[model samples]
Target: MSVYTTVSRDSLQQWLQGYALGQLIDFQGIAAGITNTNYFVTTTHGRYVLTLFETLRLDELPYYLSLMSHLARHGVACPAPIADHSDRFASLLAGKPACLVSCLTGTDVSHPTAAQCRAVGEMLAQMHKAGATFPRKMHNPRGPHWWSLTAQQLYPQLPTDIAETLAEEIHFQDGHRFDHLPSGVIHADLFRDNVLLDGDSISGFIDFYYACNDILLYDIAIAVNDWARRDDGELDDELARAFLAGYQSERPLSQAERDCWPVMLRAAALRFWVSRLQDLYQPISGELTYTKDPAAFRQLLLAHRCRSEFWLG
Candidate 1:
């Protein structure tokens, strides 16, 4: 129940009148990611997801809604935002921005197999390809600027070793520039829970709220960091290889992408490390909030720092 705004059945039913969707059959608060309030919205028409944006404003939502529409139209397995009768993807609900999206099949895998990793990689590559044609662009709010700002805020609260690592990693990342890399729209937060699987096939890539323009390789790195991660927070070799193999099968990585592989990996790790720290130390009160352990990504970042060459080589 990461529900910040509770919607009663009567209010929700009233909202459904705006959409062509039949009467709201049932709806329940979803306990998934902490960023927004979600509900499993089932109507006489179909099963869909209802999201109430906790932080993002109404006008700031078109890019994401439009992007999802674009990706879905291009055959990407993701939620497609449902436009209301007025052809608007978003409207105010419970005094917050809200939208509905077609729900896809399948549950998220906790421990993905090599095949699932490969499927996820292939899906990501497809998303990247489709995103190339997406006209509009939005800044990655959780990009480097966010990393530095969050690190500064967490420094005083962090343990000695963690703080030192954060400082060193931030300094290291500041020196590297990704301006020359292939840039495109990316699903910046493609954690395991964000991807859904139906049997052996990928049903959808959900939670596109973190989507933005960035180095294409960084998106792959984000996916690999989560999909190919082992229990000890180290890269699982076989799974990593399968993932990259699947991605390259769709779109071969440019030499520049390969050359900067390690950087992206470490950068990806550091990003999550800082975010997890924020979630742990400054958690917001919610009906049901799920915060991950910050130490997992912290350990992974350290391991990545120790690597001299790409392990996948």
Candidate 2:
């Protein structure tokens, strides 16, 4: 139900003329994501995905498109952007910025195994490695500044308990600025739905919309927050450890990263807590949009606050 802006066959066929892709056979709306409108497109030649931007502006699109292309070329399994006749991957489509990308295989896992978590960790590390060489840079848009600003907007309407919890966490994060840790391009959002598994290995990582330059550990924390979370909102130690093991296999963490582990974990939790709360309160009007439950992240944030430090071995 994520198709916000509908596209008819005729308009899509005309748009396809800008590329070398053959005649369109069929297209179906993908009902998985929450941010943008996505469709699985089939042509005589091959299958692809068409994403119509909902909130992102055209000027800020090149960084994401280029990052995906950069990652794909460097042996990272990600959707490669398809360049049109003019060597452009993005264009105005149905009055919105749109682009077509190579569609990948595999289903989003519900209950991920330690092995699967390991694979995701490996891919994320690989992405970070590849992203380091990318000349362009975009700082994390939802970093601490966003957490504070968004919290201010939420306080007036939020319950006192939630507001107090958010304020305390934000203040705590302000004390530690992880500037010295490893910095590079990070997929700020790496939840289960953003990953697809084929057998024991990962088919690929999808959704690079939130990719940006930041402390590498933050990316790991974000992934662990979602991928390693359990039914009752507690972390699965086995899975989280497996994920960290897989990542370390590719790129080892520094002592500084280890020291800041708990802070990074709580930073990741508070970020999503504020976001999910915003989505719950000031929801955007979309014909097909999915709003996740804020309760899980809230519970997770509370759980994280109880732990003072995290051990990385």
Candidate 3:
């Protein structure tokens, strides 16, 4: 069974006809995402991805569409949405807005190695550099302040340890010490599933829903946390070295970026922890869904805090 929300074949055909994508020969639902309903649509013309907007507002969509277009033009390896015959990217589907994007090749690497992490880091660096001049600025939507408030509301029964950690983090956040760090567009969430690898090299990257105006170094921290670290809670020195080396090969990070890496790592860990805990306690209502363990990131956060000095060395 596919994780994508289902629609009758007739309904799908009707929708395709409206977009002039030709008759739908066959389509398969994509089970890759938890946030949106997705399907790989095959038509007489070619294959494309159909995405039904989930949590994003209609007003918030142009940022993603524009971002994708910008990245595609700037030599970024990512999917670009295809416009319909009428030059419209969105259409109503089952009473919700939906859009189509060209299907990108390459497999999603579940267990990426250190070399792959390096490629991803390089790509991320290039992505941030290109997006630095992005004209339209949008909020992170999942920043620490937002997560703190969500923690108070959703996880009111959070364990004492977790609650205390959150309180301390909030206190530090109030000082706005990190505000002076380099700021730019950031892909706040880029888990393993969001990145695709061809052999040991990254072939493509997807899922721009979390792209927003934030610290560029924080984006690197998120990638390192997911791509360069392992489940046993140890940061692989080779992975970190390879990844950072690759990033510096492209758009080199400034001294400020390096200096703030540890704090950014801590912030990244907490953001994921809050979201995972939200899913664990108040699971979203859906037919096919999987919840991530907040404990995993909590342990990772602790580990990073213990090795806080290594970041400088």
Candidate 4:
């Protein structure tokens, strides 16, 4: 979460008056993510997070807010959006679409242990099951179609080999249809930074802006790619196995999902690679932002291409 919009103390206090959150004691900008303006807000009532939408529209926010509420109610560990005096989840802060959510209790662990990976895996599977009955039907915005378009957009700016690799992968993914696989609302960007941990147990999952309806295996692949990776960008077999085990403890994977795991791994890699490339080439300025390296995901994609069998084993 990055800060694109700045809210003044007086203005923030005035806004806080609209809610029963007591007076705003302190707030600070969060600079770890690339999407949305986020701040750690503290009040006499409790701690919370204030987020201003940087790219999401006002009309398109209900799905995310409602989904979070649904998952939280269903025993998923996630931040629940707080409504205002008018009982509205979305509001305007610094003239941008904004909302507040309860501040999660833990901190993010970058280099997680095997047990931590298991916790995240279990939580993710529970999230998918809880969201299965959610009424919203938003598609994955960074799925294959977006990957194709983004690859084309970035091709001219990249080296020949990188561009060719991206184009080829896009073509291959387009030809492969895993639509029949188990589909549900997925935390599409369940990277290390998006999950919070309280001493090896998952405290909460944050940053649901990228959440959408997608293949369940694809979501697992995304998490595994991030949480079950070694320093060299290769999958850590023990961690991966533990994570899969935890997920299966909740909802077992189908034979079809198993067959498509390798491709789904590559698909997840390609999605992040394209998005990082886009951010690298076409960046939006924010008050506080963190732009990740595109080459990291490029290396990850190549590693997945070469070592597809490693994960399945």
Which of candidates 1 and 4 is the stronger one according to lDDT? 1
Estimate, for each residue in 115-167, the C-alpha lDDT of model 2 and write its tens digit. Answer: 99989988889988888899998978798999899999889999898888888
Question: Which stretches of model 4 miss by more than 4 angstroms?
Answer: 282-289, 308-313
Model 1 regions lying over 4 Å from their true place: 282-289, 308-313
Worst 10 residues of 4 by lDDT: 282-291
Q: Tell me the tens digit of each residue's lDDT in model 3 across 24-77.
A: 888888866777888888999889988887666666788888888788788888
Q: Rank the candidates by lDDT, best first.
A: 1, 2, 4, 3
For each candidate, give its TM-score against the true structure. Answer: 0.92, 0.94, 0.90, 0.92
Regarding TM-score, does 2 or 4 come out ahead? 2
The whole-model C-alpha lDDT of candidate 1 against the native structure comes to 0.89
Name the TM-score of candidate 2.
Answer: 0.94
Candidate 1 has its poorest 10 consecutive residues by lDDT at 282-291
**Which structure is stronger by lDDT: 2 or 3?**
2
Candidate No. with top TM-score: 2
Give the whole-model CA lDDT for all candidates, comma-separated. Answer: 0.89, 0.89, 0.78, 0.86
For model 2, name the residue pairs that clash. Answer: none
lDDT of 1 by residue, 1-313 (tens): 5887899899889999999999888999987767799999999999999999988899999999999999999999999999999999999988899999998889999899999998999999999999999999998889899999998988899889889989999999999999999899999999999999997699999988889999999999989999889876778888898899889889888888898898899899899888888888877665244677988887888888777746343
Candidate 4, 188-207: lDDT as tens digits: 98989899999988899988
